[model samples]
Target: MKQLFISIFFLMNFVCCFAQEINDKEIDSLYKEDQFYAGVTYNLLGKMPKDVSQSGFSLGFHLGFIKDMPINKNRNIAIGLGLGYSANSFNQNLLINKDNTGSTIYSVLKDSNTFTKNKFSSHLIELPIEFRWRTSTATDYNFWRIYMGFKLGYVFAHTTKYRGDLGKLRFSNIEDFNNFQYGITLSAGYNTWNIFLYYALNPIFSGDASLDGNKIDMNAVKIGLMFYIL
Candidate 1:
């Protein structure tokens, strides 16, 4: 019994030591080459209707990978492709005051100012081709980059939730959401990683008489961590 106990203890200790050594070696050998990383982003759509105060901004979280090429000892560049999913929401509370026949009472909310919320969400596949300049080694990597790119996507899902004394109302457009959409991205960052800001000029919808301009714009600002895979 004593001999067995001693053997088991030695075996466990040996395994632990081996694992620790392997972990350190793995980290030391790792470099920013042909590696993949993912992160989150926030989108703020400005230039909204004057009467309507923007309540919801689009928020997105994504992951991507890059293939790097070394140009010289102090310079390198990389290209990457990634797929991500994102959701956007907008909410606002309005103060509606109406005077009917000398009697003045604030209604629930209506007309230009309404107590309601509109939300949009979609899943997207994005491809990013970025150029980077860096001074990093296998042990410690550091650099910065300027990336200009575009994303082409379609809305997979959409809905508008209107709640008031009327109870609840929901609208969904499976056809409209799939419409072709494109956006441009211009960003500057420090290190191989980048913080990007992007805007979409096209509107997802056309304004109709009933809804003025139900047009939805794809505008957002995103910040994420990036790595090079060569």
Candidate 2:
């Protein structure tokens, strides 16, 4: 997945550069700022179910294109709408299995601690809308920027993988996982590198998933660095 993002990054970059060479000069009053981006994040599970604990590092990769429309005369303030892709993984102690009837079983992973891996992953198609502010000029190559946004994504693919004492087990397209997720995001910093944060507004799992007659509820939190390419 990481390799996929890297390929997208380079491909988008080449396209952008080629487009610029075809029309290298722009009217300062109508110029746009960075419009391509890629990021890496440390994924965290919030509001975890009782006894649930993360067992390994969780990571995420993202890449996208944004259409920047300046909102003010200075061309320093803008609104951006974008489409992006993200892949994320969360490693935890929550055990998921299926009964003979193919009904999913949920539990706090039990003894032997024999399991070597237990993780769930999601791949999303995302839409992001942002209000942006920056201290920049049409000719400037570096500047400070702040972007506040709302993002919504559709989980088109998902899976769980485990290996260890129980041998190998895998689950795909879990019906209990929420198909849509929404979040609030913030990204700010200097040229090239920026700090990015996202917090989900809804749980990742549906009520059909439970651990003690109560539903399992949890959301995602991500913190990372983002790189923008003009």
- Each prediction's Cα RMSD? 13.2, 3.5
In model 2, which runs have C-alpha deviations exceeding 4 angstroms?
1-27, 110-112
Clashing pairs in 1: 33-229, 33-230, 34-229, 34-230, 35-229, 38-63, 43-220, 143-191, 144-191
By lDDT, the best candidate is 2
**Which candidate tops TM-score?**
2
lDDT of 1 at 60: 54
Q: Each model's C-alpha lDDT?
A: 0.46, 0.86
Per-residue lDDT of 1-230 in model 1, one digit per residue for the tens?
A: 35334433543454345434433545533344434434445545554433544454434554454455445543344443444444444343322222355321222233533434544455555555544444455654334556566765656666655565555655555343435556776545554345656566665443321123334332433443332223
lDDT of 2: 0.86
RMSD in Å for model 2: 3.5
Task: Give each model a TM-score.
Answer: 0.58, 0.88
lDDT of residue 108 for candidate 1: 21
Q: Per-residue CA lDDT of candidate 2, range 143-228, in tens? A: 99999999999999999998888889999999999999999999999876689999999999998989878888889999887777
